[model samples]
Target: MRNKKTPKIFLASFFLFSFLPLMVFADSQAESRKFFIDSSYDVANREQILATNKKVSSKAYFYVENDWFNKLEDEDKITVEQTLNSLAQEFDEVIYPRLTEAFGPEWRPGIDNDYRITVLFHQMKEGYQGYFNNGNEYLKIQNPISNEREMVYLNTDALFSKNINSYLAHEFVHLITFNQKERLRGVIEEVWLNEARADYAPTLLGYDDEFQDSNLQQRAKTFLSHQNDSLTEWLGEEKDYGVVNIFTHYLVDHYGLRILADSLKSSKVGIPSINESLKKAGFSEDFSQIFDNWLIAVYLEDCSLNEKYCYKSPNLKKLKISPSLIFLPSTLKTQFSLNYSTTFWAGNWYRIVGQEGKLEVKFEGVPDVQFKVIYVLCQNHQECSVDLMPLDNSQKGNLSLDDFGKEWTSLTLIPSLQGKVSGFDGRENYFPFSITASITRENQEQEIIAQLRAEIAQLKA
Candidate 1:
């Protein structure tokens, strides 16, 4: 949802692709490693520089950009220098080994004299930047700066921010992405893809598991609260960017890192990349098919590739409702009485097909004896989440005999819906699913049967 309080700026709606030159530029032409200090960098900036140095110096092969050492006043310079030295010692002692373990020997210092990368401390818009060349790259950062005061603005004041580590860890993913460049070039534009991938890295690395977990809950709320006039309105939206992290984490957990690495290096396909990424992830369904499901789950349509659940469509069938299935629509009007026998029990799967519509279900008997009809509906493959959980509260399917207490139990699973809507336990849509019912009473046994039938009347209606 757009922040009504934040002044609306002319935000660009188009996605910009970073064109990696066919030939890597020579070192002389690459962006120079120069720092432009100003009032903006301030004391906070200097402190962060020293802090980052202490966090990275253990390997000792890399050195701080000490060119401007003498440029500052004697007093200011000494304090900065001392801080830097202290930070260097900390990195050598505490941080380097851990980083080595996380990235492996390939990231070990002095292992590659040909490529020496460096991280630069600078004021950015409250995030970190890691851009790579044939040789090395730099990391630009800002805590969270905003023109107006706000709690989470990424600027100088944000150094002590709760998610500082999250931002840093995210850029660390870019370092990982750099190492996997060959695998990413084919599936997405280099810049957008890398940023999106990095956005999810912190969660993958478990930098802030608890914080990320909480953020995922917030994402569902954000997705459902607003209505954008067009998909364009939702572009570059950041309220639930952390949700991308959760989703990317899900991918790495399920499909392995290779799929993500491959997607990053893949070529750009503009809007179609949404579908291309799904296909790469082994989804054969059309974009609309998956998006429609997402719309139902989150109450907002996600136009990004990462939001897709990455599943294959199930085997589909269309059965016309014969005279036998709907022989007596009026017969189903009465409440559960002597005529209502359990012909279909919970767990019996069925499908309701209609013109431009479909539904699937397992029979869930009426909870209230006063009610006349009950059926579980699984509308599409998106809601067919039995694999994630045996009973999905979010799924909609056809009426079946097998959906009594067991199916209702599935509705009580963890991660209940919060904020605006209730009982929306997961990230799927909520639409009332309809089904036809029938019954017959005989010998004191109410033989109640519900058929998986398509609406043939749509042909005649």
Candidate 2:
């Protein structure tokens, strides 16, 4: 879910002419009140309409579109009631405390002074779960388009599903972020990090403790399909959610939740905020180091080799990235070359396999772009060892190994862009690189000659 901002000049003009009337009518305790909703999702040709208050709790006021609520079946009404009750209780007992403690508090005693956040349910454009609009925090004189309250707008369809609570938890974090980062700090957080935090909300609330059909499980599947998705890019697609959700999970799993909390409380935003938190926590690793380790951890979730290379969560113990390209060398086809492109912080894995030969790999990347090339060698019945490939100033490196397919079962090359740490835009962000791997039978020939000499000696005997 994304929040939208309106231009300041238009808002100023609307407020000057209508401020007095809006303030006089704002205090009316009517059964229904006019609210402005995003028209992008609404099928109706209207953006302003009256929504009736259906239920009120200590912490929230649940409102539904007047027409939609009136037409609901009796059984559907009961389900909505049950869902709202569960949501209110969870928000009060769990979400409110945990997120507020981690991020910060949302605007208090909000606009109406009732201390209750508003939850509005209306028909939204399909595929949208929910969103939090910061415009609601302003008065009519400041933002004439404001809902003038702390509120989250959810799709009516969510009420009939099991994911209602999780959706609410996600948007609630946005509200907290508005106050913590934008309102108090006067800095807008990068969309990628903002969505990352919100996507991690369900897990933070323990809603994903169950692996089956849980948010974490679904995101894991999505990430596997698009494992190369740039972690810093926010395209507002499912792949974006996939990358951020799993990355944040791995982050909190290894570093603890303090990184997220401290980052939010810092004046810096995005990667800088994370780096600041890591420094304050007395850790030598920065954002780049953590991301580098994460690239390996996702590919090889083996804690036996190094604790930093795997996840502590049992649910993610079996998680690993499948190789993007698999190379099997034969006498007929002894060499392979591949040229591919990737975005910043995105990873590509190349696996090489051959028998009784020397494997030589040459890598050439864009000279100006920073790249980290890591080689993972897995031997038969032995633990895998990870090492970084040394690249020159021209961003070129080579690796030559003997006993390919004999002592080693597989070798995986992982290359990722490490140059850009901040200011990531998805447009034209692809970085291209080439990798050439060739297998030679020089070692095989020497072994064959030794065997032939031993046979000749046996015949003479």
Candidate 3:
């Protein structure tokens, strides 16, 4: 189900700041204090200075930009205060405990030496819901621009929205990820997997159980529009979130939360981390094999065919890909060919409506690149069957179906690049491939002979 109007997409930023020496603030119940803000999104000004008034809670501190707070009406200000207080309670009771239990903890006794996390609310650039900066976890001597605390920055505009809690859960995961993977393990987690965990945080916290207007619902809509986006590439775009959110949902739905938790705790990064976790869990399927199953699952989300072919989550039970390209074979046009390229782990679907004849398909791809070709054969009012089209050393494969038109009502070809297991640097590598299909009718012998005779008689005359 697609929303008619644009959704308030929750976008969070994870940025690393350079270490620089700066004055640090001591723990206090101060009325106001100056803080460093990231102004990279602001084109007109690049100043990183702001003053905020603090609201203290048992487990956290909420700071709102003084200028923005001053402009709001008295009643609106009261509402903002209530929202922050509620968020503080939720964080202490829900987000902190749940995430820490699952993926480990944020740097404990952090830079501030207090068990309190800081939440800063300011007018950020449009489209940004919030962000978590690891710089805040370092001392002033290590990072000059550091706030020397476990802090998260939220856009002032989101302070009043119901989705603010979800934003907090998302950013808080990044803080924990920084500690779990980078601080403890001394390795940077891949951006895609990092974001995937954050995107799944809402679901883990039961925020997405409502489905409507939930982050998961919005991501589902975004994914339907941009299904071709690569799962491993991290461009920090909305489409990137869509891909990671849904893919992560599918992963956790089947493999359980241990996949995420164990992978984060592992010393390895990205694909290797996930593979290591899978091996430890005693699952025979590796990352590549799971990816292939996921490709089919996205197309035909029917668990009846195979448990791996569908999402067990009720929210995503109906989610499936609708191929944009469709081929119709007829006597006038008996052959069709398509040439295109795709990034690694991207899903491409092509549907073919066969005519009454034998349908033949040949797929050719770059020899150096690994390709996985899967075809789903569906007959009217019958269960569909899925199988792989085996490619030889040359990365070429052929498929022939004699009952394509009569027995099989439709055929969908899903092709993906399974190469490049690790080290995805947000670069787009397009692997070009082509698929050619032709149909041969059973009664064509007499017609060809008569046509040839007519052509020969005419040529003699």
Candidate 4:
């Protein structure tokens, strides 16, 4: 996916998945099954693992690398199969008990023993190692090519306090959150809350002291510190260990896990579906409000210098006065750049162009003020120049010099398709607009909070 420019903000690359080649599957059942079995052994080990907790699918397939086969002894080959079976059962034991408790007894074990997880140990180039979607299954590759090996290395030196368990808890939650019927996977927002709720499952299962560790909270702390400018982009893979884990931690700490889990029971699976789950929670307040509250608290606490994880200062926070500040028509057509000017710093805006009908801005700043009042200045129907408006006498809609004097304020202005013009014809892809927000200090400019940018990518027919 390509990124568009907006405002005077700093640009960052958003990384999630590593691009890889697609693996084709055999149509013949016997061949597929043979592939699965051989893949699980070493030269010293052989034999297909027979699962105990769940019935093994008669047609399940296993895949193995030729190199492991070259080194294993005949006896060790048997051990490999036994090990696979043991790992499956052990994984289930560690996982199901927690899932069943959180999701309720009705939640059944893996649907259709037909689902299979492929194991691999390849000398991959120095980089990430983990599972990726492979057709109907997941490929768990062990990359020997990694230099850091922090995530993929199977090491005896690794620590396993409750904090680490939360990591495991989070990933396991992802596994459980999968819908076998639709073949859904990963931590999309709707499912994110589920995993977030599960993040506390370790504590519920009796691991409290570790939950209190300063190191454990690093995940949430990192996200809380950077919410404003780069979360969507900053939350790339390398930083996920903390961001995802911490979001999960926050979910449980503020909203009880049971409430969070109950919220997820009926929740949808992707970003948009998150609202469905939030609705199930029956909290009259919107999820954004709740998120803002949690975000504000986190940012303020994490910004402390004494804290292990401190957010760098000198960040620009942008707040939008409207759904979007419309820019003059751009038939330059293919691309547009967005920029923001703040007394504190110069920020950039994200370009809103294309058939994807929506614009989004993430307003980020230190938390201190109780509320914000916004003003959108634009020519009646045409785009108008927005003079930085002051926050004083905002209830009266007036501005003065006091507002432009501060140095730490930033507003991330975003736009969503509006009016009858939302998405009609090819025009539905975009609405031309340029916009920016003026920051005001309600209390003292201490809290740093960021409003996430969202563009409605789905179009109605």
Candidate 5:
């Protein structure tokens, strides 16, 4: 039962509150976006403008500031121009329409008759690829950049050399959010959700960063390999861009991508806005409930096992992690719960020792729990054979484990989420769950039955 197995359960460690993929900032991440107020810094001294290039017909302007721009050949400029134009088309053709549908009529790109925003194709200090600030923040009361127009300070050196599409996609989402949220709700989006959505932009465009880099698998492996790890561990850590991306993707897959628009227009700012978005998107379950399903689906993603309860992560079928061995000291009884903040599929394997005749195992999940089941399968040694199935429905409450195969010396208890984690009202995400598992033998059952029979006989006499 203690043999090494490979399985990565994502739910065990749910620390994804600081959903990421942002730098510490070239100069104050907190201050980077408040451009209208912070004019003291001399951006001009760092790099002199070599040339101002324009297509006359196009709305976007490329202001070449660093010497690196002058160094590029004319052919390179054409490539940059094509890429920028393609992005602009993406904004007009797809992004704008979809976002407008989600946030409503007033939520759109640009404000004035020109409807043009600025992208400064200049040099930024190293380490930053590109950035979008509320260049229109001065008109904050009337909505963020529509009146003044948005400007993206580009790090041409970084952009030209790296994955330009992905870089642009990420920053563009930021610009969209600023305009949409400010225009509609008159408030900025919450930083975590705002930043998380920005990272999700690349994924939305079909560039799967998490799956491509195997970051989801790698991160899930960390949670599965270490027994002590939990969602609480990485709650606010900054290296969570991957975590946030997958989480957002899961939401889109389950409820359709409209959740983005619903989240933006809600008057409720941070988490509440997410809940509101879920509600608008016809999801009875909010962030917390969906998170519960996500935890189970991250590992148990096999649609063959249960389609209604699984994610569409095709790669997950090939990626199985080694389950951590749960150590039990006394009677091999333990009380545990599913309260982590992650939505990855994972479970624990417990070796049930010193038992033979009709061993009984019990599980008790949280009230209103939807996906709690106990699996009894052991696959390690040849001498031991107790390959059993789970014992419980998808709902909450105590379930009996009386059907474990006979003549099985070793047994493995796998507590996994068997159903979609949702609320009766379909609006809660954080559900408190616990299972108090205690084992009993046939002898104990017989003794209790005999005592009841004796009492009945005495009453008859």
Candidate 6:
């Protein structure tokens, strides 16, 4: 074979281009480390930054990086100072007023205490928002990184008043909830409830940002389709924490923010505490029913129907439907399976049509795992009412429906991971499962009673 020698220029170009991505990858990876949530150097071990930098107080709070502040130009320094002061003002003016108005004066902290929010200005990752340690009493923020200026010389845009204020407002709620003057409970509140309240905090404080709106819409569109996913499994993630926000926002929208604050003060934990707050807010439905309704409202985002419950983004996108059920007679058990399985924070939405006959729906052959199934009277696609059940360790719930009548063309069934995820990382390739749904005649009693009542009325007439 003739020897075909490669050009020296081609060899050099190939070598350089091949490693270019790796070099870029390395730089990007290094940059990402800066924005870890609640960056590693918090008050618990801020000694490294504190060793040389004096803890200086801005008009609002204590910051441990005087050296970083001194490096700022005079104009930038004033902006930083005023921004910190504004955070304080937001807490006192916005956060406090909302809490007091929602709750009562008695629940408000009598006087500000030794603890104050501390600002940590560092280069956080691309999506790295600030983090809060109610345990540490600090609200850490990342110094914006821009090609226009160094991190220390970031301009007013880097200050991100709305963003920073929202962070402060949200974290401050967590701090206040943990260290409530009345001290209703010593233990930390449930994770979902805690974050739900935190998410609601920013909105009530008037610092509502696009982040919350966009995230809420995304989650609603994502989870509403799979209402059965575990609402409790948010560990080392951001969006799961945001799902809890919808719940709290719903509470505030219907009940008011006081219920959430009061939830912190009460010994009741998780759903029970939320239920108590709901009762206090004069809501008739308990958390379970409320959650069920929330599922339906999320799918059918019609504000006019009072189904308009969640903090939807302005666009009010529609919920994606999945795994529709096959209509079957109420005499035999019919199995309808999911066409495609979903992964973490994702789910399958189903619908089964029925006649006025009493309809019974059940799930079976389901693997022993944590998951949620929402049953809703979905006669019209636009009008839906949701019901939730957990099928765990070979558990399933049966539903009987004759009251909805034939107007209910179909029922919405959503089977999803309740987010009770364990054993595998969230990104496992999803596989379809043999989940069965069946319909059967409800007992004759419901109809018999109706006939009996009708007969008695007719006889009297």
> Which candidate achieves the best TM-score against the true structure?
3
- Deviation from native of the Cα of residue 246 in model 6, angstroms: 1.9
Candidate 3: worst 10 consecutive residues by lDDT? 1-10
**Model 1: per-residue lDDT, tens digit, 2-75?**
11111121112112112222332212312333333222223344422321221233233222334333355688
Q: Which stretches of candidate 6 lie over 4 Å from their true place?
A: 1-47, 51-59, 62-78, 100-126, 134-158, 181-184, 209-229, 302-336, 339-348, 351-362, 365-373, 377-411, 416-433, 436-461
Write candidate 3's Cα lDDT for 1-461 as tens digits: 00011012111211222332244444455467777766654323444645555567676788887778889999998998888778888988998899899988887666566677888787777767887776666656555777778888787877788788899899888888877876677677788888899889999999999999988999999999999999988777788899889999989998999999999999999999999999999999999888888888988887888999999899999998888556655554688888989988888998888577888999999998889999989986277988899999899999999977788988888999878878886677788999998888787677678878998999999
Q: Which regions of candidate 2 fall more than 4 Å away from where they truly are?
A: 5-30, 43-46, 111-114, 380-382, 425-428, 443-461
- TM-score, one value per model: 0.37, 0.89, 0.90, 0.41, 0.54, 0.57
C-alpha RMSD in Å of predicted model 6 compared with the true structure: 17.3
In candidate 4 the C-alpha lDDT for residue 447 amounts to 26
lDDT of 5 at 289: 61
Cand. 1 TM to true fold: 0.37
Off by over 4 Å in 5: 1-51, 54-59, 73-82, 85-114, 122-128, 139-148, 161-163, 207-238, 313-461
In model 1, the Cα lDDT at residue 255 comes to 45
Q: What digit string (tens of lDDT, one per residue) describes model 2 on residues 107-169?
A: 776565546788888888776888877777676667678887889888889888777778888
lDDT agreement with native, every candidate: 0.31, 0.80, 0.80, 0.31, 0.46, 0.48
Rank ordering of all candidates by TM-score, starting from the highest: 3, 2, 6, 5, 4, 1
RMSD of each: 16.9, 5.3, 6.0, 18.7, 13.9, 17.3
Across 333-431, the per-residue lDDT of candidate 6 in tens digits comes to: 433543446544343556677544555666643464555677666656666565566555765566666654465767777655533322332234443
- Count of residue pairs whose backbone atoms collide, per candidate: 50, 1, 2, 61, 24, 8
Candidate 4 C-alpha lDDT tens digits along 1-461 = 00011112111111211322334332232232222222211233343222111123222222334454346687865665565454446435664466656754311212222223322332222222222221212212322111111111111111112243333344344444443212222222332333344445554555444433533444444444433322222212334334444544444454455555554444344323434555655655444444433333332333332221122211211111122223323122323344332211001222222222122222332222212323232222133222222333211122332322122122223222111211111111222223332223343223222211112223321
Of 3 and 5, the candidate ahead on TM-score is: 3
